[model samples]
Target: MVSTAPFEEQAFGRYRLLERLGEGGMAEVFRAKSFGVEGFEKIVAIKRILPRLARYRDFVAMFVREAKVLVRLSHANVVQVFDLGRVEGKGDEPPAYFMAMEYIAGLDLATMLTRCQQVGVRPPPGLATYVAAEVAKGLDHAHRRRGEGGQPMGLVHRDVSPQNILLSWEGEVKVTDFGIAKARDSFEVNSEDSRVKLLRGKYAYMSPEQARGRDVGQDTDLYSLGVVLYEILSGANPFRAPQPLETMRRVCQADAPPLERLVPGLDPGLVAVVRQAMAPLPSGRFVDAAAMHEALLPHLSARHGRFGPSDLADFLRRLSEQLATNRVPVSEKTPIAAPSHLTHDVDHDRTDVDLPDRDDEMAQASRLLVLGRDLLLQGDLPRAGDALGRVLVMAERHGASAQASQARMYLGYLDALAGLPGGEALLRDGLAEAAAQGHRAGARQGRFLLGRLLENIGLPRAALVEYEACRRLAITDDDPLLATECDEALARLA
Candidate 1:
């Protein structure tokens, strides 16, 4: 469990840190309360560069430069950047860079997808279209932004995955994470080196040009948005593969299966819209984000009768209610004292804790599992591995077999990421355990991850078997995302 001591006492500028919401490789986010005179207080999200990364001049410059552009953006569909500055660290420590932005009190698209899987329902097609269209509107704004001299800024959001698309409880769709965005006036000192050193966005959502390391413009963002739309409407990414290299290959070749093949009754016109947005060549795609947004509007309005934020808000409210009752409740019993060995610090002076009994240990294990997953998504592999390892140990010791299997599944993915051996064994064991326990979701995830690992290891035939198995499981379990993923993988292998 994360200790609240450090965060409770920390203050970045006028924002008093309340809790560590989540973290990624480059930065950590905190839910903070900003103070002002006359009892004025507002909750905000404070994103700060990781301490170790602060010393990297290139990354620091990019962070500041991105903040400059973000601060100038104001749109209902975009998260507003309120303040950007450096906070002095304690003692002789170097100052930390931070940006306070509008805090969104809702789930990201990824989390919402998971929630949908849990509840056995997907968002309505109209609602999905609306969300994607809203994102396109935001991208259009950034794409057409002007500089101090009213010159075109030519901003391109390099990263436009589900994680960066937030859906508020009030049904607001907001696009965030401009940290990797490319703009005409960017302050990046070494653009070529930066591009070569790191791939900016998620591989599954990257455009063909981006996957090929070529120059990207507004069209690239539209392509990424198309992927998001496809996932939302059909419950899967069309170009996704079991491995990054394979996924990139499929992307470069534009090898996604037709939408109707996955979502059998999907509207042909809607499919055409997505196809145009995700066209293999930039020249074949929509001219800009605005054109794409306009194309989606008529379809959205026709199918869902004046669909808007209120309609989405109502849908989300219902989903939340369903999830509230369906989700496993975390143990509310007081946390036991931590064992000496488990008391080591993890980050921001926050120490880990070990509970005394099985119930408490299981609770702690669950929390650690979520923490590890978040870290993994953020590309902090080392810390993610450590957290998942702890979960495995704790779950095993407490006789939480199902939880242990979950931990093993993630550990297997980490192994694949590191190109280490034994990932197959871990996934196989986890899959068996999940199956025995009737955990369909866990079982499907295990198969999916295993397929990825197998493909990455040059075992294409074996990967096909796993993907086929997952496809069957997805169909039986009514999981569109898993089914779509399997379809994409099968298409690549074919």
Candidate 2:
């Protein structure tokens, strides 16, 4: 809330601390600018360890670990750390350690949730799914990261909550405060050499094992994320009790009420995804974050096609504008803050971003369909099936009927070519559906595939009729390439 940083506009280890953003028990964050030669300056958030704790060996080790791990991570959904250094404090003061990080000009998920609760509305499911899925994408990247010698890094955030998730006004979802996972050989993240019971993450978000102070794995983070999602969608954390111990006990023993029981008419698909992520046993959850991401993305596939409601970016922008209009008087005490669920993180906390609206996911499906079609035509059955199968599932999920039919048409052709059963039936039914839907290209391809199947069955006259139909459709569509394929087939039959 300070109008200006006390050490305003002056250099401190290649950076000028402009203003404080937030502070917690261990460190303070400042909105600073990094100055370079030739008039270069870039705004960065500098996380400076509190002078009192800078000399503590274990705390310093933890701080160094946070910086090291953050520097290694590069993701759109994860905050970036660029530099770590030390600077002289005021005369007779201890040296200050700091880590410079990416400055986000938007609010944290905690703030968003609070505001939404104030307004008595939940974030749209599209936005919720988008957040969960994007965060999962970042987690998946970190989960798969390998060390220099190709060993699995085994990095886990150990904290995934609304506070740790930042949504920029431009629609970026960034997770903050990584590097919490202990080294690969260590079984517990929060455990030190003697296995002290110092708290590491919020109890409401803790996985069952983590709450019990036992070994945790990557699935632990997924469980925490599921808790966040549950709270966002249901407006309550089922495990949160007045007492921390009670909360931990509930996390270990109580089953979460089904999403439908809490919020009726929720997408059953998404409900299942969230429930699986929060399963008490890690084995019951998704095998990895990648699987969770795949299951969640289908929910967002239909977002781009919807109208009337603004997206998450717009919601944040409007919220920012409203908060600014009501800003109360303040001064000198603000510190750079972390997203609550994951502390020691940084955020922008202001400004607006107008990200371009995402195009409907069907566009992606369309491209995959075309690629699958080309691969099928080239006799690459395995690759073609892989691509076509994905496109079919995606198209079907998003209600892209034409695309789904075309996917079916191509897959049926692949199946027949590979001598699989039910090929002819699939091709004929898909062709009928595509033709009824007025999918000209799908109909054309379906005719050619059926003609080939008929030829393989020695039905020369039926195959001739199929080839002739395909040739007419291709010519009418001015698809010379497809017409050429039909001609080659007809010539072979004759």
RMSD for each model, in Å, please? 12.9, 23.1
Per-prediction TM-score, please?
0.65, 0.60
Query: Per-residue lDDT for 44-117 in model 2, tens only?
Result: 98988777667565766777876876788888888999998888778877788888999998878988876653
**On a 0 to 100 scale, what is the lDDT of residue 233 in model 2?**
72
Going through the candidates in the order shown, the clash numbers are: 0, 8
- Which ranges of candidate 2 are over 4 A from the true structure? 1-10, 90-92, 181-199, 303-310, 322-494
CA error at residue 475 for candidate 1, angstroms? 24
Off by over 4 Å in 1: 1-9, 179-200, 302-304, 327-494
What is the lDDT, from 0 to 100, of the residue 365 in candidate 1?
A: 63
